[model samples]
Target: MPCLLLAAGRGERMRPLTDTTPKPLLQIQGKSLLQWHIEALVAANARRIVINHAWLGEQIELALGDGAKWGAQIQYSSEETALETAGGIRKALALLNPEPYFLVINGDVFCPGFPIAAFTSRFQAQLSNGNKLLAYLALVLNPPQHPDGDFYLHGEQVNDKPRDADFEERKLTFSGIGIYHQSLFADLKLGEAVKLAPLLRSAMAKNQVFGEKYAGPWHDVGTPQRLYELNQSYDPK
Candidate 1:
């Protein structure tokens, strides 16, 4: 399956640092954020990658080139204006079309050494079981910045609302890592700017969305302080 890395946001919260450099180009532990994901993905043997960028998009192209350095085939889905997650994915559907399902990661978040292959396996396993899931999200403990959380996860099912029954359900923050079927965005028109949450919520209502909590070091890295903290704590080992 192919992977799409979202890198088009203007990074308004990141301010001056992003004024000249795209958010994904911001470095932590001596590697650009985008590079971290690339290295991890390539290490997992996932070689087809599609990166979408708008702000300073060319710089990303210049830096990563053709992905030869990492032995991957990198393609760019350039946008004149930044498209929100769903829109970006919809626009890049052509590149991701060969595969019924593809992986999508938010370019700004930092989660080093994520188990991409494992998640792929889980997704495939579910598919083989004959479940028609449209999306599989990797959820994480809510960060301080987003304590309210995004979605509720009960067992392997993700829901927009908590169930009234007795089973355990915990609301968690979206780690911005997910595997999606191409059909999730089939209703979206190409180039229409749309956020991903609504679509996921819609899928959740139909019980088509599933999630697994990722108990790993993860950071949203939306601000400079968050980036600095991550770098300061990084052991580089």
Candidate 2:
């Protein structure tokens, strides 16, 4: 499946660092966050990459070029202004290929051992079995910043319910990684800013959304302090 890296966020919280550089270009262990994603995607054999950018977008193009060095064909979707998640995906749909499913990940996140191949295999198997899923999210344990979590996962099914409603299950944070069917953005207007949560919730209500809890090293690099902490603790060697 083709991959889309979302690199267009303004990084409002990242301030001075993001003032001149896009968040994905921020270095972690001597490699740009975007580069890390590209290398990992290439290693997984998802070689076709589409990166959509808005804030300092040109720099992203200049930094990564066409992804040839990484053995991938890179295409870019430039937005005049940052199109929030779903809108950006909607705008880049044409570049995502004709396949029914594609992979998407947030650029600013740092997830070292995310099993993209395994996720793809599972999603494909579910699809082939006629179990139509609009979206399959990778959920993680809630981080300190988002203690309440976002969605509840019961077995492999995800729902927008409070954790107290089902004491047996715990709410999980969205890791900003997933495999999505093209139909999820079919109704979205191209280039319009729209958040992905509403769409996911709508799908969840219809039981078309599925998710898996990933117990791996995942960090949302939203602030400079977090970036510094990651760099200090990360073993690049």
Candidate 3:
């Protein structure tokens, strides 16, 4: 399946740093965060990459070029303004091929050990079995920045409703990594800004969304402080 890397957000939280550079171009260890994701995807043999950029979009093009150096085919989906998540995916759908399912990752996130091949195999199996999942999210333990978390996971399914007061089920954060079916965005209007949560929630109501908890090295590199800490501790190799 083709992959879409979301690199368009104007990093308002990073302020001065993002004033001159896009968040994906921010350095982590010795390499740019976007480069890390690109390398990881390349390693996974996902050579056809579609990146959507809005803030500093040209720089991203200049930095990565045709992706030949990385042994991948790169395509750009330039946006004049940030189109949010769902909208960006909708806009870039054509470049993602005719596959019913494709991978999408947030450009700002840093997940070093994501098992892409394994996840892809599982997703393929689920689809082959005739299951109708609009999307399957990779959930993670809540970080300090978002302690309450986003959704509740029961078994391998996701639900919009929070767990009961008993706290038997733990709420987890959306890791920003997911495999989505094209049908999920079939009703969306192109070029409009639309957040993904509402769409996922709507699908969850019909039991069309699934999830799995991934307990691994993952960080939301939203702020400079987090980036600094990650650089200090992480060895990208």
lDDT of 2 by residue, 1-237 (tens): 999999999999999999999999999999999999999899899999999999999999999999999999999999999889999999999998747889999999999878888988888877787877999999999999999899999878889985465466668999999999999999999979999999999999898998899998999999999999999999866
Worst 10 residues of 3 by lDDT: 162-171
Clashes of 3: 0
Candidate 3 or 1, higher lDDT? 1
| Clashes per candidate (backbone, < 3 Å) | 0, 0, 0
The local distance difference test score of each candidate is 0.92, 0.92, 0.91
| TM-score between model 2 and native | 0.97
Task: Tell me each candidate's TM-score.
Answer: 0.97, 0.97, 0.96
Better of 2 and 3 by lDDT: 2
lDDT of 3 at 27: 92
Tell me the lDDT of candidate 1: 0.92
Q: Residue 76's C-alpha lDDT in candidate 1?
A: 96
Selected candidate, larger TM-score, 1 vs 3: 1
